[model samples]
Target: MAKKSSVFICGNCTYQTSQWIGKCPECEEWNTFEEQLQGKTPTSNHLAIKQLEKERPKLLDEIDINQEIRTSTGINEFDRVLGGGLVKGSLILVGGEPGIGKSTLLTKVLGNLSQRDVENRVLYISGEESTSQIASRMRRLGIENNQNMFIYHEKDLENIFAEIKIIKPKFLVVDSIQTTLSPELQSAPGTISQVREVTFEIMNLSKNQGITSFIIGHITKEGAIAGPKILEHMVDTVIYFEGDQNGYYRLLRGIKNRFGDSNEVGIFEMTGAGLMEVSNPSEYFLDDHENEGHGRCTTCILEGTRPLFVEIQALVVENKFGNSRRTTQGFDNNRLSMLIAVIEKYFGISLSFFDVYVNVAGGMKLLSRESDLCIIAAVLSSYFNKSLDSRTVWIGEVGLTGEVRSTPRMDIRLRSIQQLSYKKIITSKKNLESKEILVNNLAVNNISELKNIFD
Candidate 1:
């Protein structure tokens, strides 16, 4: 009797579909199509009651702001990612693989907050762990359980909200969002729809209730935060706790930060108990290679706004067989090929008959173009069996024409070098023109001049 009802669908990157088709326009997953009841009426989400509540925000000029109210998490690296400190009414989403220390990091933050003498009680809602499992971790950590830190073992979203009302805690945490379910939806827990609904409600609560909430989200096989992409979009801040489980070190990257700069990342090491902060990263990167030779050199890489000194090792040997091998770790391979091409074309090194292997000393990956100058310098130094001065630094972008290009944040980079007590830097002439750039010594804008000095 009624006209055919239209089916609800995923318009972008659709993992699910409404009907079978030759090509899937959403998400490009051709056959991953599942249909649900199309005619069901959508219900008003009671999960997000906090957002539905009435509040009138005053104009900025009319309200007096407290600059000191932004709270620090007691971890310098974590605070850096959060852009100074935690803001009230901000929602943060953290995701990683199982046994990756996502829960451990959050627990550490909560432990510190529990020690504080504030009216705000930290509510840790653990939907995954039982009371006994949580107890074991606390015992291993050698930290006493907090009387003010309230723990819950519930998974129902409605009940979780009810507990929020009863406790009226200032800070809230959901150990994981996937385990929790809402009563309004007929779909099973962990469904795309349910995940989206639950997170939406939680984010709304943080804004309306003035509660800073931390939500631990599950990761997909692709290593991205699971559930709808919207789950990440809805939150004020999104961070990923990532590392090699077999390795000792861990990395935290801020993918989306509404309050602060997003490029910042924190590095930590996992101990027998919990994660210990890496106060001195340079020491961790340095290996036992005290003996130096022609093929080895030291390089400084710029991570975000911070500069870290690292060692680069290169090996060159004659290849007897055809198809010479060129391998590199931490440094990109294609970029190495480009550099080799430059060496052959510009310097006439004839590397096509040899095997070259390059590696950055630690288990770190270099992402920026600032490492270009150092990498090329190392390759050339090894090929010619020559060594560059260890006390100096080289930083510049390598153009296709084999010319060094100027990099951004030169002044900031110089300040980092000063802290490390480096004496000299070899860079492009464009950067030396700025009077504000004050370094200990200047070796600027003369790539040709630098080689001539060594000659």
Candidate 2:
């Protein structure tokens, strides 16, 4: 006989309780607790021992490395973010804000993959959209309705798995795991329990059948995948699309990858013909050079193994209110405040009476602290109303005591700057020798030295 129990579970954090509560103590979210009925645990443990073809474990040198391979989606940007290409039997999760081009990107990949081989079958099961809706998008993307490409509107996990078993597709995509549910669970779609179970089934199906699967996930209001934290654990790779929805730019960031590097990022521009890869992101971000030095400066930072140059702009105005407002776009707000405090304490510059605004060009967020020097220089330039050299670049971190710190990959950054035809570069004097370099490299030990160079 099956037994049922009543429990309260938090939708945000998956915390369980015997009784319902107004707020979740773990996530501190109010009105996120829902009452649900729990079914008895199944007798068969899915993760337990499985009866299959067993092979003896071999030593490190005995195994052939050539057996494992990756399939290219024919999209360079997508392939770059996946650390070369998609591995067979890998489960990848893509999450982002609503209307962030997650579906569009995947649709384009499907089209490209289908065009690569007529015999390769790809199935895309959309639980949130109908066949007609997907077809309309395909037409807009100029993707032909080919025989190898398949689309099915399904929300039932059993039916989806049945179709997968029958077709034996080489590639699979689930529009979203939230809408797909199991028949045995009484919980509604998008619930924590339902999402967890559906993802587990998909993972098992992909691994057991050797199908490369891409699962789309809805994000929470906080911009995280809207399920238990373990949801990220079950997948082989997890990437998110980031950028301004209204803008033309999109950043693909890989947070977790079992097959490749996780710190890598891919840049793309959204256009009428789907997403287009940005071959030279530095040129795209620094397209405007008319008013370079007044409040703008360039800095290079490492994104995985690649070095990228981005522009930073700052503006200072007299404060109209009691408290000076500090606003930042594409940079951390708290970090801006801390930097302003450092400027005031060491340089004796009083930004207390001014409203400060900082922006990173092209709507891209910066996760590196190497841009600290450029950001500080832009602010000081705007404050003093001085114009810096247009062909100059700044690359270093700033300490609380007004010292400039060396950044990682100094040679790579310097080479990139020189390649871009920058006349001068500012960095720390710790370990670099610039006697043989073509571009003039000025080394500074502290922020005061940087300020003196401008003075």
Candidate 3:
């Protein structure tokens, strides 16, 4: 008998190898190779013809491209994150940690859309939950299963396609791609090969039928979505549900989108009834310790297209360990260290032997330089024991020489604060006070002017 040829596969990236290797050459993941079925020949590609048949010939001049009309969900926060509304024929992928409310969010979207008085129908297919469970959730969501909405409980791909054809829903949602299995492939659900095949099949359905489909996926222990990177590459948009399980807030971030900017995000606070859209993040970011004492200050950090005022609180105490203990929450620790060094070098603030801890209240992230001045001021306030004004909001970047610098999109930031009924805002003089710029009831400029206004 001839020696049979074997195929080795990397469980991490789904890369195949002819022989066994300790490390996967494609994804560089070590000890991730597993011996799949030994094949004398490559598996036939079913998707190649699907792709070939789907392409339509069109000339650049002949093709009519109109401005995109976004279909709003009537939820301002959701629309804001989605860059106005859902684009027709857009395939969206939502992935996240287990029990992170991925299914709940999609259910809410379907329920709201079904409530609209339109002729278009919507389909909600669940591979994870039962039909009865979906019915229960719909009732809880204040939605009754009506003619506009169709609920399905299935894991088989062929039947899913058959149902899609009969119904011809305007929008579609696959509750989870991991639980879905294809009969052609003899792999278990949630496995890398299975997930890839299942998702690719749905992507084809979305493209060929002009149905906007949302396929939900699960994350691995390392936080990356399970299956090959090819799965993410296949989708038109990728979104992730993020936040600690113990926390009350959930963050919806767009990691990739073909129709809109990928940086935008939505915040929702988990409530007794359901997830509530956080219209004004500043209300949660800034705490009531405003009238209490020092060690805390307000700062604005720009997230995608939205400007937000978050509180930066610090506590500086004499270090018992001598080397100083520095810790931060909702703020980057390494960046905090660099800012502390800059403050000490520029303003002669001795922080070598002090224990420093920084936190952004309400557990929201701060990713920009606008919080630099606020962190410095908060640290100083802790050391000097001076309480900052409750009505004031500060937004500026602090340079190495103690000079406050300007940030991008100052107009948006000030407008957000003004709309929130805030009375005072302190920013870089150069950015806001330009002779060509104009706004109403705006005051406070530069760090020097801010200090003077405070006294």
Candidate achieving the largest lDDT: 2
TM-score per prediction, in order, is 0.88, 0.92, 0.87
Q: Score residue 138 of candidate 2 by CA lDDT.
A: 89
TM-score-wise, the better of 1 and 2 is 2
lDDT of 2 by residue, 1-455 (tens): 75677898887678999998898889998877877788754333332113224458899999877755888888887888899998998999999998989999999888888888887789999999999999999889888858888999999887887787678788999999889887758787887888888888788777877889999999988888988778999999999998888899999999999999897899999898889999998888887764646788888888877788888999999986759999999899999998999889878779888999999988878888999989999999899888877688888889888888888768777778778899988888872654356788888888887667557
* Residue clash pairs of candidate 1: 13-27, 14-26, 14-27, 429-445
Instruction: Tell me the lDDT of model 3 at 49.
Output: 28
* Model 3 stretches astray by more than 4 angstroms: 1-14, 18-24, 27-56, 399-403, 421-429, 433-455
Tens digit of per-residue lDDT, candidate 1, span 1-455: 86653333342243444465655675664443434344344465455663375668889898987764678888888888788888999999999999989888887787787777668588889889986777667667764856777878898898999888888888888978888877776666766676877887888888888899999998877787867777888899999887788989887888889988886778899998799889877667756545556666665666655567777777878898868888998888888888778667766568888998888876777777766767777777777788766656778777667777787777777777777776677777786665455455554443444465335
Superposed Cα deviation of residue 387, candidate 1 (Å):
3.3
Residue-pair clashes, model 1: 4
Q: What do the candidate models score in CA lDDT, each in turn?
A: 0.75, 0.85, 0.76
User: Which segments of candidate 1 are over 4 A away from where they belong?
Assistant: 1-16, 20-42, 50-52, 56-68, 288-290, 435-455
